[model samples]
Target: MPLSGDLTGDGRISPMRSTAVGIRSTRNPRLEVPLGPFRPPGLSLTRGRAGFGSLVLIGALALSMSPAIPATTVRDQEVAGVATTGGEDPGIVGDSGGYATAVAQAHPHPNPIGRTDPGGVAARAVVPAVVPVVFGPRTDETTLRRVRTIRGQIRPKSVVASGAGLVIADNMMYRHSVTIYDTSGALIRTVKDRVTLAALGWPDFPTPVSGAPVEAAMSPDGATAYVTNYSMYGKGFARPGWDLATPKDRVDDSFVYRIDLASGTITGAARVGAVPKFIAASPDGRWIIVANWASWDLSVVDVATFREVRRIPVGPEPRGIAFLPDSRAAYVTTQYHDARRGYPAELYRLDVGDWTLEPIRTDLGHFPRHIVLDADGRYLYASMTGDVTVIKLDTTTGKIVASVRTGAAPRTIALSDDGLSLYVVNYDDDTLVKVGTADMRVLQRLATGHHPVGVTFEPSTRTVWVACYSGTLMLFHEEG
Candidate 1:
């Protein structure tokens, strides 16, 4: 196997110290054609220098006497040294006598040693009179070397870092209280909910909605943290929310509790929409895009004003929202619910400038949930319930060039700092797959907690953070 070498950020090949050599032989000299078509009369060359000296003296006299036999070719009888290896081409070169014999006897066959090349028995015994060691200072030595390290601390199933510190949503309690931990997962403050639906404005509610905050996303300036409350208001006898006495009262409106990070207190709460699942920010950090799964609408909120700017109607069950850089447009995914209904889902291009919504392309696959764009803003990736699809989007034309498959049930995706590979969370398989963006191949798979949902890469930490549906947060380190 070819050992892996550390490459630069630009993907340049940097040669490392190797111990293996690759060899190839040149064509034999016996097959060479004679210098001339015929030999000249009275002209003879000897095998060695001693024989050649006497022959050269005789040949000079014969050349004067023999006018009929034209001198076909002149042979140089001096033994010359030839470099059979090393230098530019690492091939044969003719030079002086003793060196030529030594090189010819030592290297009778082809031998080429690279940095990794293993020195043979003859090469070990014979040393060059003037050994040349080529050395150059490492290019870009100022740049820090990236090394992969194992995460010393085991991540919880789900971590929501809010104003109240880090909260771990654990399934151990079943319809439970949030586990409040410090930055290091040590228990800090646990807040249990005793208030009913009426306290939060809703009245005549039968089954009270429990608090299960799955993921928490902070505002760009780090002032507010929006904690997504993923709770169902029903019992186990039927499907979730099916046993409700009143349908409207039974509907669970997921809340995004806006907590002031600096104050460590809940400042306000916004009723975004039903199943207000994942949250994303606009390029300018002026708007927050929330994906409402049940309503199939993207709720755009103006950050400064803290009000609903516009509700862009998308496809069925929009789960992921990604804003394109340098533009007022955003892309949201409509996850497929039923294949028989031909609801293969699409990416809705929401124009924030005009508050208009249009379907960009609908041909990706079933249940396209999570979406992310490349740093160059050329390609857009949608992770579906079946397979992740890479759609080459022409930003000007608003059209898709091609769509390629990625991984099984890809829920969330994040790009590396260098943008060479994409990290995807496979929710169903509970694994994270690293995919190469250039060739779109699965590079590596990492075991993660159950039902990983939100995926984000932190450049400063060089760690991939994953939020899980099973109430866990996983931190994966990049492999060198």
Candidate 2:
């Protein structure tokens, strides 16, 4: 059958026909994806009587159709600037100046404080798929808290918390991935949705077949979660955080999966620019900005329509993303480690009002990873890798005002609700450190699981949740 229509709903995957038998490997991570038009080479068209007369289209090509389930058709809409497929917008409450009002509302369901993962999944949790190894040495904090570790896959990369206390962690290697927890440092549910897809008519859909979920952001009202598939589209599995894509080189164009937090269903998927890393929803909840690593740009999506409205160009390998409370401008970290691009990662301010990309003043050996702004949005906090310091940047000056020493490779940093405390996740040392924003002194040194990549402060429980690549979700709470 010839491939026609959008395989994953991005015009990039075009239709094709072949006369010779061509077998393409489904697991080839190095598949050559042309930037010019991309046509699926999955079909093997051979010399036969019906070859010329045939027009084969795999309606379920990448959708992973299940033979037992009945088929359903969903029309595509011309939304924002791009097209959206899958299903209708049921979460949208009302439209105000093109913004989806319902989507911006927070989830009303509250989280349990101090308690952990759903229904004691920790004690009865299934054995690790692989022999369990230590992510870090067990310290007093680990022994004290009992560290509610949600183990499933090997590499749990990032975690995002919803307003209602829903914690979702990104699993890099396994299928039926994405472990979930509540506000109490307890496992709530596994994001693995096999039945939902089949019910939606895609029964046999294979899991990703390439990419995996890395970073996610929840809508203010807490109804939806938008997840970025780190390198899912073209050779995504080969790289975890960033995927390389150029207009003429490999396609590497990525996708963001829109999931219903309550339903455990993937409602829709939007195609963004190549190798999308960090995703952030504007405070106003009208727009979602994604930092594309390879294309050296940002895909700005309208929340109401879930479509890419603008692709803002920035520096190479942009990772961390932070939106101002007013949603006027955002601070982003452009990693300095790309050898092809050369030295000193830059920090740029993207003005949402005019869509202007301006770089902050700084130079030399400053490798930035994660960025978090103060509650008032007047100040900014960033974690720099090479220097191993959390540098405070004044919004007005755009220069580092203060710096504090910490463990190696600080990746994810979160600020307390009142902006009094800051939490930094050191990937190399596997420690979660809390620092006072005022004095910039090390407040707490809590050990974490292996390759601690994601950290978030939960207001409901007043606890901090950490997602470890060693397949553990470690939770820390302060005692009175």
Each prediction's TM-score against the native?
0.54, 0.64
lDDT agreement with native, every candidate: 0.43, 0.53
After TM-score superposition, the amount by which residue 452's alpha carbon in candidate 2 deviates from its true location, in angstroms, is 0.8
Which candidate should be chosen as best, given lDDT against the real structure? Answer: 2
For candidate 1, write residues 86-193 as lDDT tens digits: 132211122212322332232222211221211111112221111111111211111112111112122222343321123233221133333333222223333332
The candidate that wins on TM-score is 2
Q: Which TM-score value belongs to model 2?
A: 0.64
Residue lDDT tens for model 2, 45-153? 0001111123311110111111211001101221231111223221111111211111112112332233222221112221111111111211212211322444544
Deviation in Å, model 2, residue 310 alpha carbon? 1.5
